[model samples]
Target: MDKTQNPNNNEMVIDLVDLAKALWRRAWAIVLVMVIFGGAAFGYARFLVTPLYQASAMMYVNNSSINVGSTQVDLNDLTAAQSLVETYIVILKTRGTLEQVIEEENLPYDYETLSGMIEAGAVNSTEVFEIQVTSADPEEAERIANCVAEILPDRIAEIVEGSSVKIVDYAIVPSQKSSPSISRYTLLGLLLGAVVSCGIIVLLYLFDDQIRDEEYVRQTFDLPLLAAIPDLTGKNSGSSYYYSKKTSGKEATP
Candidate 1:
């Protein structure tokens, strides 16, 4: 059996070099569009988005009080205390503790809302842990964090017998906002700008149909070369050039 048939691709050929050239020629326009989008995004994020502030209190778990005559906690005791960090967190999040915080602070938030604002996590998986409160008002965040710090140990002792923790650092009013980072927002805006600008350029390149020179005809139609025409002006710049009726006036002979 003869196997001389070559498979035909039948795919339309795209000139990436031409597309690249077209994009390069309109680089300034693309950059302008990108800047406009990026600036708008930055402005929206900076001015419109609500910023959140975080205040945290650092705590150290101390189980030594339960170990009579022990001056310092052992490694095993510390490991066991680390295990109780979650129990302490649970006690801190109880409806009773949260309701008390709201009552003492006279917060407008209810149990559920107040609970949602507080977060607890272990630091480096050791006995140390942090209680963070996030709120729109920085002072409120600090107050809530401190309130939790002051109340957590008592709550833990009530729930877990002979378990206690000490405050390493009290919550302080944060000077800066935790959320709505301007740099991150600006970066996202720039990425959006690049995508939008590049998309428009690609679309314009794909939709353009104007042909330039004999090369276009030969490649597009698979046609053989014919007799060439000579340019008298010797300034042929192809379809990319526009033949304008507006002409540069000749300088008067001095």
Candidate 2:
């Protein structure tokens, strides 16, 4: 028979169908491993990991005074407000402001710890930026965020001569947790379990060299099949031949 042209004639790789069969044969085992790992991950995330809540406050940066009933506005002022966000972020993250916040709230955390929990960023490249504070307790997160909102404006005004920040919205207590996602952890655990299990099975299938039957031999060793026989005597065993000995001296007893 004529075979199609191929680029890789000698390169050998594991058959995907066989690998899939091996995985399917151990489907129950794989599911069990996935469940075990997923349960463990869920337990760890739900019970052991500490949950955090986040409270957010919004602030607007005012670059200059806007005249009343103005038909047109200067685009440069809007651009200036956007540019001022970076400088304001730097001042907001300073140790001095955080120290004052710690003093005002009587929080136990130091500057580094408190700074790690706070996040500040511009809202969609606009003049409005948001400040978020995360804590183990929702009420504490709200308190810290509100305290920053109350303290940051005057602090910025004092530092930057003309620049000032105005509070657009105050912080409110968060109703839901912001971290320690149980479902995500569980899914990751399940995926890891599946990868490990399937990897081991595939490795075993690829490295195994034991012969199973005649068909396996023909496919792997490129040997021609000489003959084959059906099972006889109702025994599920390997092939065996039986024959009567030739009658040498005794006459044939038809």
Candidate 3:
């Protein structure tokens, strides 16, 4: 048995050089298709999709007041507190909170639609949680974010104690818009499209049995290659005479 016949033999494996050569042969077509699709996706993401501005307020819960009777919270109590925080985050997003915000800010949209854009999440490794509000209007996002952050702790404190919970950090009005990350979104789309297009090109090349290489001609016809005739466009650039001579020789053969 031939040593090369073993599937484990590195010599029998597909080479990067061969794969690159195949890709280079079809580079122009790939570029043309990818450019077209990339431009289309970029335009749609930029111009067609609605822009959303986000404003977030961060807060840290220190758990400052410790009870002497029940001095330390057990694992179950900690889990339950985290669960309650998550629930309050949801409640902070409801119409009740939005209604207060809308009445205070005199917003144009109804509570239901306006509350849809708001999002909240706890920061990992710490008791810090963020209340983020998003909208087409920058001021609305800022207003909603500040209102939610203000009312949330007070409401939570009322359930837990007689006095207000201490606020570690106050919500500052954000000046920058957060959504439709143009550079990030565009770059991500370009990268994704490139990978998908490259995979498709590779698959097509693998499955295609078309005779496009000098090696294919030599193996199929059992002919010795004296010369290779490149694409007509490439030949016309500087090597017309050499390519014409090769074509003439092939034609002269009986």
Q: What lDDT is obtained when candidate 3 is compared to the true structure?
A: 0.62
- Which pairs of residues have clashing backbones in candidate 3? none
Give the worst 10-residue stretch by lDDT in candidate 2. Answer: 245-254
lDDT of 1: 0.78
Pairs clashing within candidate 2 = none
Better of 2 and 3 by lDDT: 2
State which candidate has the highest lDDT: 2
Candidate RMSDs in Å, in order, are 10.2, 8.6, 8.4
What does candidate 1 score on TM?
Answer: 0.80
The candidate 3 region of ten consecutive residues with least summed lDDT is 1-10
Candidate 3 global TM-score: 0.59
CA lDDT of 88 in candidate 3? Answer: 65
Best by TM-score: 2
- lDDT string, candidate 3, 121-200, tens digits: 78783455777777777777777777777777766675555323334555555566666776766677677667777888
Better of 1 and 2 by TM-score: 2
Evaluated at residue 185, the lDDT of candidate 3 is: 67
